[model samples]
Target: MSLASLSEAIEQDPVVTRELLHEVARRSGFTVAPRHEAAYLLGLRSSYAIAKQVDLLPDYVDPRLSIVPTLGGSRKYSKPEPDRNGLSAWCHFLNLQAVKTETRLLENRSIALKDTIAVGYIPQTLGTLPHFISSKTEYPHSQIDATVVRRLLLAGATLKGTSICENFSLSPMSYTSIFGPVHNPWQRGFNSGGSSSGSAALVALRAARKAGIKGLDDLGPDVELAIGGDQAGSIRVPAAYCGITA
Candidate 1:
């Protein structure tokens, strides 16, 4: 039944409401205080508790089950490597984005000791770099790429502000200067688009399936977009290189 209808029914029956809250608490993995009454207000509280509880599962365990594409990258080749190494790098970045986003979300709720996995090197690199979580991450012993991503994502969501993911580019020389160059997937002669080179290539090959563009909007039939365009070669460059329309 719809939540509204269920709520009305709950308000009308005290005995039923008490029983229901007891049952819900047991099933929802929460400990209800003895002093807490099983009233409509408590029931409403339980609903959100249930949501947050369930939300933790997918964030921790399931990479495929995502409401949002929390990661991005490209599909071009830079140097010779084994078995499309650049492509793999791209996939790692995408995977970590989702993981990081989830992590951020969880931490914002102050859920203690939530497990986070780093998507790939990015999380690890960032952890080692100057960041807030790194200090709490035990100075290199406790950092997991996937875990860090999940933690970061969870944190990013709770701040009462616009949530946005933007596109930025860096050339081969530039990227390498920042975070070493990635190996190529195809041939050595080909150039994986720089900046998000690895991620773009992965999305094109279906190795990574995530919307590069993300924004909050209240619309029916949720938007499923893979990439966004801003300036020259922001998204369209990857889209065209990958042979995708959007």
Candidate 2:
């Protein structure tokens, strides 16, 4: 009896055709099988099921998310190769520095009030700037007055200006201490979009709304909250996917 008949008699089930091709390929070390033919046979049912599933699935109809903060005459934070040293300082320092520079520029009127609210991993030389936001279980430095903590506090204060209402709050986000994947509000399994992951999550989940945006004057200390930009599609992609519009 043929091998096929013998197997049918023993198992009482038909074998996948691709398995036979795979076995031939393995023994011959190479075979003249048709390109993607095996895949076509194996995935035929799954492909049809997927097509029907897509037909049944609902269509996505929503306005695309936009880049907020309006960093006029400036490029958004799209880093190609960010500095290594920048990471250790908890990226917050860079953010603080950028805002400070912008404040200084504003004082000089070098850039218009409506200039783009620059934020990136590495601070730009002139047109753009960078910032960081970090959250940790235990303070890295023993003394709170240490450089890192001091910088964070200083940046916070600097971002918070004279007006009481203008002052924005900076909150802790993802840290290694927390453990597990960052909580992406849109899709729980995915990243929340950190190191400012929590901040973006808040906006995405509508846990906290934009509240209001008047202009540069209205911008608060929480720069991270004001705009979302991470190297790996942190802001734009999630904002687009989640249908966040603000």
Question: Tens digits of per-residue lDDT for model 2 on 1-246?
Answer: 454644344343233356665676679797546787656544543444445556877765332212212213332332212232111111222212223232232221111000112222222121111122224432121111223222332233222111000001121233221222334443445543333342344344443234432231211122222343344444454345434553
lDDT of 1 at 115: 11
The lDDT of model 2 is 0.31
Q: After the best TM-score superposition of candidate 2, give how far the Cα of residue 197 lies from its true spot, in angstroms.
A: 2.2
Candidate 1 lDDT at 30 equals 82
What lDDT score is found at residue 24 in candidate 2? 60
Clashing pairs in 2: 71-116, 71-117, 72-115, 72-116, 91-132, 92-132, 94-131, 95-131, 95-132, 194-197
Alpha-carbon TM-score of each model against the true structure: 0.28, 0.22
